[model samples]
Target: MNPEDWIAHDPDPVTAAELAALDPGERAARFARPLTFGTAGLRGPVRGGPDSMNLAVVVRATWAVSRVLTERGLGGSTVVVGRDARHGSAQFAVAAAEVFAAQGFSVISWEHPVPTPVVAFAVRRTGAAAGVQITASHNPRTDNGYKVYFDGGLQIVSPTDREIEAAITTAPPADEIRRRPVHPDDDTLVDAYVARAATVRRGRHGHPRVALTAMHGVGGELALRALQAAGFDDVHTVASQFAPDPDFPTVAFPNPEEPGAADALLRLADEIGADIAIALDPDADRCAVGIPAAGGWRMLSGDETGWLLGDYILSTLDGADAATSVVASSVVSSQLLATIAADYGARHVVTLTGFKWLARADAELTGCSLVYAYEEAIGHCVDPAAVRDKDGISAAVLACDLVAHVAAQGISITDALDRLALRHGVHTTAALSRRVADPGEAAAMMDRLRSNPPAELAGFPVTATADGDAVFLTGGDQQTTVRVVVRPSGTEPKVKCYTEVGQAVGADLDDARRRAAAIELQLLASAQTW
Candidate 1:
């Protein structure tokens, strides 16, 4: 794995003209650092040489993907492709479709742009061998990615990704790819996805006063269709930032979690007196929920929404056989779910921190109905039967439905959180991420933190810590459970540091809240010095 040999298997220019035409800077960049396919699939800025996610790289990757299916006795299988409204996304989607078709696979393309999750669900619904989504998933505007889903509609994990990377890096020349024409009706997957999402809708409360924003991506239309199908005839759309634009003109970064990404929707909600505001990321697999609280449309953290949604689902099911197995990430908030599962006679399991892991793990862990699975990063899987992967459209419908169910009890979302806090004790989580300019630098930072462990962080004495190859999990499991896991972002140069603080108060919410906050401050301060 010499640095120079990373792209050794990549196709070289057969004709001097092709190499001559490549941008000098791009050629140099690719030569210096070829794209490394990781567990998260291929991701990088849409620039550089053949190593980047440009047309040449995409074609090669598609060939690699096709080769994978073929090797697994799944070649020429149906392939469903979806795309977000990101820059170059549409082109990438078409390129993928063309390549899949050229490889003799029937490609079920989307006529219009659709959410990333819809594509994953469609792969399972249509019995496709695999699916591909063209999106970066909240990354900066300059970047784009290729996310692959296997036959079961879950992302490819560990060894599978490694195998795919080998195929991609050693893929044949782009010109050698078989070219085929796409039929007029090759994009029927959109209709199927829209229809399937309709089944998850449980209707809204009262007039269904809610504001919706697509963050200038392609999810708004499909979201509206699902909302209307669910009988929410009055889902108000935010006037601005509602259209599907590749550039994402309205927001700096198309992610809804950032400040002001939900500003337009909140402003509209305030003016219309809406009960809730729903914001979906550019690709639509991830979504954020905003409730009318604290005088404005206050956005609920991923953990808060998971608790609210889990509570609603658990209480609504009437039968004793209505089993609930609450699933969450290793880094997510387990306070509410752990308590609620006990009360409902359900088992709570912690999996590695990704929707792919949660989805696949839930399927593996037997003995109970996998009620709900979510991670702190706004990914949620509501009906595992319908879609084994996270679906923003389905999550959006379920969130509104939960609001309606709670409205019947004359309670607001904030009040529900407070009651949960009273029952399960308070667990507040905070995250701090620094953008290391180089991947090596990010690795170095994690190395330094591991080699020189802090004896005392802030005020609390460091009880114990676990140093992983690429991450570290530190802090005392009692009083405050501080988890500091650092890894090079699968898709970006940034290295994320996750911290969680939990306190068990028998039933005293105030005491738990104070202790959790104090622990959080201590963890943050300690992390800052690192």
Candidate 2:
């Protein structure tokens, strides 16, 4: 179809006007290719293009989702729609609900901005056929997205996503789908989500002064409420990031894992003499933690937090039925969690590189129960039974509880990390992201690494190689060693290289860190080149 055809059917006048103003080359670039669903759903810049995130793209995606659900005998079933506090989020969410309703589906629309996991929780809780979240997660303000969840509250896997893409390719025009007003609901679901998140607390600890940052996302108010409900009363929030701000004025990037993203929270923690600090991403599905250490206050790496929380959760459930309690992490995450789980007589599973795979560990494993799942990019699924996605709120509650319990015993989270390091032998990890100009460049980078992988990284020979959409060019598999995973970011134009350098705490933790850091730095510098 031509750009003129698209402009005629486009629902948003702003988009149509923009399309009309584009030159021949610009118009061809915008409408010649359509944005397809990737691992993270339909994400792109907020603009008027078939390849960008806009009203037409969202409407088509929503229609495709409805068709996919209805094919499975969910014609009249209810579908939940939620949005975050980003540009065009509410509008995109409304457009999605309208499309679903036009397709003879019931729409349970969230009128206000909410966390991404809230929509995931609502899908399972309501027994809805599917759910849609209008968000870009930690992406910049210029971008937005549409993420779909199937009946099991899990992100759609291979065939389903492919099927939805097929349906989207031939879906009806935006003007053909009838627009409908979204009916608002009371706070029943929100209250239920808060209650369920609070139940993750074992009532083991209380009264630890916590300084938290919401990263200028919509999770602040709800996160604060969940903390109070979980028996933590002394929670102080960073005022600059305490409210929902679409522009995210306080930080260069809204993602907590980004450098200096948690600076405000750490500063507030130091001022308030807080025991710990937690940072929730823009949509509050990924969590990053910080603690006051001997040198100063520093944010913990995703692996460090993963190990701490995994150790805590596993030990708490130690006496349960043997081989029943299970934990999961992404393939790119630290191997220490699996090692710990095995030593505790519990089962551990490693999935692909996202929460979409990590969240379904329990359903895939026959007999084991999935009590925990985590990724090295600040995503953790603490209570998968309640929310089948990486939930920043519940993870923070557990982190705060652990800090309180340890603080009561005259120790800090840093001390707990030291004990974990001594036991797990210092599994350190780092990520090297090389941003590209476009998705094609990202794919080219991945292909380059696969075709011509580094024979040796940091003086360690490439021991093994696994090639696919992502490539694992590793150096050691000595039960605990080094790895480099090269892949394209699902939702952004970036080729990412994740590196992990693990070593035993031979005589001193400091020595182990020194060795690991040297190896990690070399790997990172070389990884960045590719």
Candidate 3:
């Protein structure tokens, strides 16, 4: 569509003015292609045009979602709509709720910002036909998104996402779409979610001194409430970051996985002599942990936290039927969770690199339940039964419980990790992400790597290769095994390569760790070339 046509259809005068101000070339670029909807839903910059996340695009997307659900015999069914504290989030969420209500669906809308997982949890609790959350998660402040979840609380997968996109293509113009004002629901659901989240904690040890940061997202108040409900009274929060601020002035990026993102939390932890530190990303769906190291303090890598939490959760499941309980992780994550699950007599499965896939792990195995699921990007689904998505709030509560439990056992989190290493070998993991100018470049890089597979990386010969949306290479000698996964990121314009090296612990655990770290660095160096 041309700029004139887009402006005519745009519901918001601001975006329409933005379209009017753009030059012909810039306008053409903005309308060159519509935003592609996938399993993760629509994500883009908050600007004018069909390709951006303006009010018009949101209305059309909601109309399409309503159509898809209606076609599945869910026309008047309940739908939960929520938003985060990002720019344009409130408007988009309201627009979405109106569209759903106009389509004859019962809409449960929130007046205030809520975490992404809270929306997911509400879908299951209310038996809603679907849920939509207007959030870009940890993305930059300029970006926004629309996330969709199906009846079971799991994110919409392959065919469903494709169907929604197709429906979106057939949607009417924004001005033509019907709308109905929706009254915001009460906080009963929020209270219910907090209660359910608190239940994830096992027998409580004395409250450990915990430090937390919300990373300027919407998780702070609810996270604190959940922890307090679980009997964690010694929790301290970074006041500067506890409030939801869309600008994210404190960090270069809103994501907790980025360097220096958790610096303030760590500083507070050190000042208070905290036993554990937690950082939740902008939307509070992903979590990063900080701990005391040989130096002042260091944030645990996603894999390290994954291993610790996985071990703790499995350890507490003393009498679960081994064959009926399952734990899952993304293919790109470290395989240490598999070892931990096996030790506890539970089954482990690997899915594609997203909670959407991990959430459905239990469905593939007959009579099995997903006890835990995590990805290496600091995303953890500690209570899949309650919320079938990565939930930083519940994960934080459980992490605190893990700290208290370990303290009661007369050991540190580091000691628990070392014990796991001794039993399962020193498994080290690292990732290399290379940014490109555009998505095409990222795809081209993946294609090039796939077409010309390297024979070896970091002195380890490539013994096997598996090809799909990503490429997997396995190689090593008898003393060690190396695995590398290279793929284009689903949400960003970059190609990511994940490497893991496993070595059996010898009499000197330090020596084993040193050897593994060296190999991991070499592998990362090699991956940089690709």
Best by TM-score: 3
lDDT leader: 3
What would the per-residue lDDT of candidate 2 be over residues 157-178, giving only the tens digit for each residue?
Answer: 8899899989987887788877
Go through the candidates in order and give the C-alpha RMSD of each one to the true structure.
3.5, 1.5, 1.2
Q: Write the per-residue lDDT of candidate 3 for residues 187-290, one digit (tens) a residue.
A: 99999999999999987687898899999999999999999999998899999999999999999999988888889999999999999999999888888989
Answer with 1 or 3, whichever has the higher lDDT.
3
Return the number of clashes found in candidate 1: 0
Residue range 117-184, candidate 1, lDDT tens digits: 88787878878899898888788788888988885787877677777778876776565666576753
What are the clash counts of all predictions, listed in order?
A: 0, 0, 0
TM-score of each: 0.90, 0.97, 0.98
Give the TM-score (vs. native) of candidate 1. 0.90
Off by over 4 Å in 1: 1-26, 184-188, 201-205, 318-326, 330-335, 367-369, 467-483, 504-515
- Return the lDDT, model 3, position 137: 93
Off by over 4 Å in 3: 1-3, 464-466
Evaluated at residue 494, the lDDT of candidate 2 is 83
Q: Which RMSD does model 2 reach against the true structure?
A: 1.5
